[model samples]
Target chain A: MSQQLDLLFYSLSDQTRRDILRRLTLKELTVSQIAKPYKISLAAVSKHLKVLEKAKLIGRRRDGKNHIIHAEPKTLIKIDSWIEFYKQYWNESFDQLNTYLTTVGDTKNET
Target chain B: MSQQLDLLFYSLSDQTRRDILRRLTLKELTVSQIAKPYKISLAAVSKHLKVLEKAKLIGRRRDGKNHIIHAEPKTLIKIDSWIEFYKQYWNESFDQLNTYLTTVGDTKNET
Candidate 1:
């Protein structure tokens, strides 16, 4: 799971890959179409696609000779859950601290 | 911002660092206390702390000779916002597709 997340984050860490993902989120596009806006070579774009594919963030379908790439939004849900876990953990800790402080205040009032 | 996220995700890519973040989330702990549970060397744990610090996921304060490490949950919020942007984008696209499909169904029924 950690390795999967590592690949997912590493794939997203690049500007070009993120751009590709943003574009893919709108609609499925051919490899050439996705690569058209960038100044990088087709090979570079292919490399980015490979990374995205490895992370399962995007899926590729071959239609005749053209490769169609679409964003896999579900993978993002996995990341969301991971972040949510930490968010809840932090919230719980803060609640505990708040309770402790309140108890301390009540004790001082009694004194 | 991409670079900062790259650092943030990169710092989290490792299991040890994630564990450290989890521990810090519970309460502030000294470098020694954080390192005590693991079999690795103190230097190795320190290196992990450095990565977490660079990502701003954890902060250290010098109290006498001890460096107190605490979790900075706000950095996770930045990541949450980034993910939320994509989530909204994908949701909007899905809504558009749903509308189009509904229109197509109505046209088919009218025929």
Candidate 2:
């Protein structure tokens, strides 16, 4: 796939993954429970979890026979900050700050 | 390529694309002007532009013989709102909004 905001967003783009995130948002749940709502195989949900984990959008905790997933908000916040930077396209001060931020350390490596 | 945030962010993950975006942030430039800094051929820059256009990160304006690229901030804001949603992973009231947003959305069809 692409990489930057792409990976982070695409991880979320999938309907199954989104549902899983929604279910997790409601409350952390076991893998099977998270998978229960979908018609796909449990392994499919497992793959989605792996993707979410790689994206760091969610973290998994082993609880008894099931793995419980919790949302990790930091990376998500980074994406917000990046997206929020676009406001600079319209706001002057935001523009200056964006110039500073984009040109900041290793931004070319952003994502 | 993955369609969700993945496609969006991944398009951005490349150093060359980031530089192109940085240049655009400074001012809109023709495709050739945008291609000058990169050691790669114009064809490569053109390819990147295609990716950015598909991602909707930038829009093109054909002026004379050049294509002037401009940033499209709306989609970025959508990403922001999405990332912002995870903030609800902590804030309870935000949780209500999250449910309202995600479940209300074609959650499974997210991207």
Candidate 3:
């Protein structure tokens, strides 16, 4: 599971791959079409797509001659769940700290 | 910014590092104390701590003879924001797809 997440985050760490995901979110497009906006070669774009695909962040389908790519939002959902768990953990810690401070204040006032 | 994020995610991409983060969420501990739970050498644990510190996921303080370490939740907040942005984008794409499909269904029925 950690390895999978590592791949997911590593794939997302690149600007080109993130941009590719953003573009795919708008609409499904061919590798050539996705590569058109960037200065990088189609091969480079394909490489980025492979990384995203390996991370399961994107899906590809062969459309006769062109390869169509679409963003797989489910993987992002998994990432969100992981973040949500830690976010809750962090918030709870803050709440505990707040409660501790309040108790200390009350004790001081009582004295 | 991208480079910083790259470092952040790369640092998080390890199981040992993630476990260390989970431990720090509870309370601050010295380097030796943190190393006590894992089977790895103290030096290995220190290396993981350094990675987490470099990613701004944790902070360290020198106290007398002990180096106290604490989780830095703020960096995770940044990561949450990035994930939130993409989540919204993904949701919007889903809505658009839903709308498009409904329109196509209605058009088919009309013909």
Candidate 4:
């Protein structure tokens, strides 16, 4: 799978990770701080961070032994653009089909 | 996994289906015509169509004996909106972090 698409979906698929992202929405936090809300082990949280990292949805820097996790919103712009570009294809077709069904039912007059 | 997210990613994760979507980009196609480009089976292609249908990315209707598959673009707008909403969470945090790094880095700054 393409990394862009992989990261796009992979980042959003996990419930715990989505929760973490939601938390990060409020503020940036250290790894342990982000881990505080979950009953899962810190190691599991660490693993989640790894997934986010590979997706480029989060960035990490060490503050002594602690890692500050920051959300990268721009990382999603590509994915947005991708989905946006392809959207016209499906959208327009459905609209035409709707028109066809509404005003031209088996008229066979399309050029 | 949530069905919305499941359908979102599950639909796009496959190469054959993406190709099918791309072809649908040019025009709507029947199951057999859609299957022509791939080395895979017509049944496999039908399975792919089912996935797209489950995602609500495509729809089907019978014209006599042919199943006319039409692209449903509106289905993607929800996904686009979902991504757009979360994007703010990431974007703001990242911008704030950038600001913190730039002008307030460990300088005994008061919040």
**CA lDDT, every model vs. true structure:** 0.86, 0.73, 0.84, 0.77
Distance from true location, Cα of A102 in model 4, Å: 16
Q: Compute the lDDT for candidate 1.
A: 0.86
Q: What local lDDT score does residue A12 receive in model 4, on the 0 to 100 scale?
A: 75
Candidate 1 stretches greater than 4 Å from native: A89-111, B89-111
Error of 3 at B39 (Å): 4.0
DockQ of each: 0.40, 0.22, 0.43, 0.32
In candidate 4, position A89 carries an lDDT of 62
TM-score for all models, in order of appearance: 0.78, 0.68, 0.78, 0.71
The digit string of per-residue lDDT tens for model 3 on B1-111 reads 877787787777787888888888878899999999899999999899988999999998899999999998668877777777677666776789889989787465576
**Model 4 alpha-carbon miss at residue A50, Å:** 1.8
lDDT of 4 by residue, A18-38 (tens): 678767756789999999988
User: Which of 1 and 4 is ahead in TM-score?
Assistant: 1
Ten-residue stretch with the least lDDT total in model 4 chain B: B1-10
* Per-chain TM-score (chain B), model 4: 0.75
Candidate with maximal lDDT: 1
Q: After superposition, how far is residue A13 of candidate 4 from its true place, in Å?
A: 2.8
DockQ, candidate no. 4 = 0.32
Ranking by DockQ: 3, 1, 4, 2
